[model samples]
Target: MRSLFFFAPLLRPHVKRFALALLLALVTLVAGTALLGVSGWFLTATALAGAVSFNLFAPSATVRGLSFIRILARYFEKLVGHNATLKLLSTIRQWLFGALFPRLPLPDRSLRHGDLVSRLTADVDALDEIVLLAIGPLIAALVLGGAMTAILFALLPEAGWIYLSSLLAAAIALPALLIGVTRGTGAALVEAAASLRAHVLDAIAGQDDIVLFGRKDHTAIRFAEAGETLSRLRRRQAFATSLAAAAVTALTGLAFLATLYFGLSAFQAGTLSGPILAGLVFGVMGSFEATNAIIRSVGKLGEASASAERLHAIATLPSAIREPLRPVALPEGTGIAFEGVSFAYPDGETVLDGIDLTIAPGEHIAIGGPSGAGKSTLLALLLRLRDPQHGRIAIAGADIRDVGLADLHARVALLSQDSPVFFDTVRNNLSLARPEATDAELFAALKTARLDDTIRALPRGLDTVIGETGTTLSTGQLRRLCLARTLLAPAAIVALDEPTAGLDRETELAFLNDLPQALANRTVILVTHAALPPELALRTLTLAHGKLEATV
Candidate 1:
């Protein structure tokens, strides 16, 4: 109920169409049942008249006219129902995508490829059936049930009473039995789906390592287990769904028998005509099918409720970083000050304590720290990925929180130590920093990053398609490309984290050789364990055991 209730706003735009479709279905039921009753009477009257040598005088054209009405009603009613459902699907898809966008930055890092894909695609597929499976049939059953009872009451009240009572019993039992059966399956299915996604992604991402370590068989076993587990869940859900459907069918069949047994007795007592007797059976069949539709709808609500809960969980994640509601503009000149800044993760064991620092615009500073000394954490705060738990970090004498997030990011271009290389062409990867950069500019950055020779030697030069995560490129080449990308960015403030971490001696010298030309005129903050090379004016700061002290 909670999840289904939350989903109402998503359906607001299509409510009019939904209501129209329901009305059309009502018109269809009334017209269809009435046509069946009228045609039966017309046939019987024509037959009796003919037996008296006057059948040729009966109006056969009346039955033909009513048959056409049934055809038109069904066709248009189905059209309206399908059209309304299609519109609702489009709205639901938009909501799912829109709800997840704001949470992407600090997204569940634990999230894997398959899990995201399933939520975006497969979960949506489940919902398409839910619309009709829940509401449409419920309304259809009520309308048809009441209509049949009204007709039956006029013919023989006892027969109508017996049949309607049984129909009502099925309606009440169908949902209650289903709720008991599928009570615990939804949460389990959701977890199983997520786990399968994670396992598949893990196997693919580690394919290279798996082959080298001779662990392919191990991964296969794990994947098989995950697949089998999810399969069992699906089978159980399906079994429960089938069982409920079967129960409804059996109950409706009994109602039909009860109507027939009692109707025959009424006809012998002259309480019901021959045409009315046949009409009662026709009405019961029409009525029960509508009732059965309602029964199936109850099972569908479980699925919708489950999906809605998952989607809501994603939408409600507290934003990791909160920007100022009334954002201050970025000031001129890029000086930064870290004033008595102290930090820790959520549990509160310190990562950086009592840290303080300042750097003027265009001043190149290298921050050297032992491992786990808060070097990367400091840089992350400077880039505003996470704010300090205590103390203030001001940029150009204005607190970073006071500035709009977009403006702060635009002011600082982060060249992360991991310096991830996307598996795009050399030119395409380089152009991410400045999308309008020309071919000549790209070649210039390539030369400065020492990747010009490698690009030229390739068969397609800059158009080479580096495989996934730069698997086709060496570590040194990947780092140089990452540096080249940062060179093309238009920010005065650039922060580099261990840019030379995995480089060879020759590659290291080449990177430093072109470093000045690439880093010229910018306020650069370099995170490295070693000293800055001789080519740049520099200051040094050291952080050790979560404490910072100037060591220039």
Candidate 2:
């Protein structure tokens, strides 16, 4: 419940829309109660006074006006309510994305991709009940119930106590009971749904591997178990909601009977006329409409509370890296220095130990080593994706820690070993690094990466939409496309990890031969096992057992 209050700040911007929607909803309920009351009184009076004696014109006109107002108010109420809810959801998604950026490379690697997706999509969607189902409806019910009780007390004193007690029981006590009964089940239902979604996504992503390994049946059984768990929790929540609804119905019936009994006694004593008693009774029944909505949706209030807690938990997580209070400007020059740098993973596996190295501006160097030798970790430290546990890295004689992350990132660009080729057009993929780059500039980058010819051969050329992870392109072409993106970044220092991985031997050799010229004035740090041509005139180093050694 406390977590649900986290959204109050976000609700401020949309207050006007929400207030107007609430106003329209109240008008709709009030007009509906009046319509039912007037129609009951008009029909009885007309039957008693015959066609000529009764004044049908005034009562009929009043009923028609109330009905018209109810219809218009109901329509606008739905319109404004849904519009405001959707706009608020849009704002939340934007806020979540904004909150997510700085916390990238989240410390907790155990958080699966699918579970995160569920929180962002399904959990966020559930919050709509906060306004549409829970808050707005609850407010409307209270206002209508209070107004109806006041009218009964003023006109039909004997029945007012019965009506007020019944309204309080239905609107307040019943929903509270429902929430208490269903809270745990509601939260479990949300978790079970997210788990099921994660299993489905995992199966879809690993379908090929499952089939190849002959584990399809095992995977299917796992999925079935998750589905069953979700179904069981849903059934529990539904059963609780049904019981609450039944209680509300029973309460409504008893209240109606009691109000009618008291009203009849008053009429017998000549304190209340038949037409007025009928109107009051019908009004009492009409007022319970608000309670019905509140009862039916109380279960979702539990679900919304659980969803808010999950979202709040994720948004408030401690960031993996903290920005400095006052950042120093990156000095001129692209030279990089690693002075006695050492790093270890959270599991205490030392990747780099007491490593000292330096590269002058515009120098091209290649680092080679066996797998798991920490060549990649060095690059990550330089980019400040993860700071070293010991010593410091400097750029142009200034400690990189003192420089702003954005400034340091702009000064250096990296094409990692697992760099992704997004599901987008050839032009769009390349333009990610430089959105305002010209078609000519894009073609130049693609040509340098030796992918322009393949793209040109396609019917749509740069406009061709690639499949997910570039499934439409050959593995080598995909690698080259990602390479072109990295090359397009306007940075003085560029790091490429296994950039020529999927290229054939011929293409690999050709790319390496032309690499120096393609990156003429930029400092290049290449981490690969590929043999470099002597003509490239680049220094070569090797990393082994957490130490850097000059290659002969």
For this target, which candidate reaches the highest TM-score against the unseen true structure? 2
Off by over 4 Å in 1: 20-125, 208-225, 325-327, 347-350, 366-375, 415-490, 497-519, 527-544, 547-552
Lowest summed lDDT across 10 adjacent residues in model 1 is found at 54-63
* RMSD of each predicted structure: 5.4, 2.6
lDDT of 2 by residue, 290-367 (tens): 888887778888888898888887888878777888999999998999999999999899999999999999999999
Model 2 CA lDDT for position 79: 96
Clashing pairs in 2: none
Total clashing pairs for each candidate: 2, 0
Error of 1 at 171 (Å): 3.7
For all candidates in order, the CA lDDT equals: 0.76, 0.87
